[model samples]
Structure formats: C-alpha cells, structure tokens
Target: MDFKLEFGITDEGKLILADEISPDTCRFWDTKTGKKLDKDRFRRDLGSVEEAYQEVLFRLLGIN
Candidate 1:
C-alpha cells in the first residue's frame, strides 16, 4: 500500500503535516519468494538493481 506522511507547522504554533512518500524511501519484497526488492539489492550486490528501479518507474507510469 502507498503511504504519505504530511508534516508542517500551523500558525497556532502546532506541528503539522508535510507530505512525504516515494518508492525509494521504502523496502519492498516478493511475498512468495521473500526476496528483497529495494535498495538492499544494490547494497548486497544481488544484481538486477537497474531493472528493479526501472520496473518501479514503469509501474509508476502505468506502463505495462
């Protein structure tokens, strides 16, 4: 599921929400295989890192 946390400061001297959300900010995994599909791939040298980022971009663009 997608999530965005909003944060900001109100004139009343209260903290508020400022939007924050992105594919890169979170880790994703294949539930069936338990494979990491996030930055871990790059960190662990698991390969397919470019494809993974491109996949996220393509899917975000709704290009199947």
Candidate 2:
C-alpha cells in the first residue's frame, strides 16, 4: 500500500494536508495474487474497476 499527499501553506505559515486520500491517490495489490486493487484498473482498461474499489473498501473496513 503506497499513497500520495498534497500540502498547502496557510496564511500563518503553517503547512497543512491539502488532499483527500482515496483509491485514486494510492496503489493497492492483493498480497497473495498480486492483483491491482486501485485506480490502475480504470486507467489501464483492466476491467472490474468498481469491484476493485469495493474490495479495497471491504478490506479497509474489515469486512469479509
């Protein structure tokens, strides 16, 4: 699991996280099958984009 972050500078010279984290911003793969479970499916025309996103959600929420 790898993710990206965006930062912004506030008027008071504070650096704050400026991006929403989601599957679109990260890469995930199945540990056993090495299948991609991120946005790559959409970009690469791999199909099952929705299912991949749902799988990620289920895994994150500890669902079966």
What RMSD does each model have against the real structure? 3.6, 1.1
lDDT (CA) per prediction: 0.70, 0.92
| Candidate 2 local lDDT, 1-64, one digit each (tens) | 8999999999999999999888899999998999999989888988798999999899989999
- TM-score top scorer: 2
Scored against the true structure, residue 44 in model 2 reaches a CA lDDT of 90
lDDT of 2 at 7: 100
Q: How close is candidate 1 to the true structure, as a TM-score?
A: 0.54
Q: On residues 1-64, what C-alpha lDDT tens digit does candidate 1 reach at each position?
A: 3344767888898997666455466676667777666676889888787777776678679998
Clashes of each: 6, 0
TM-score of each: 0.54, 0.87
Find the candidate with the highest lDDT and give its number.
2
Extract clashing residue pairs from model 2.
Answer: none
> How much lDDT does candidate 2 score?
0.92
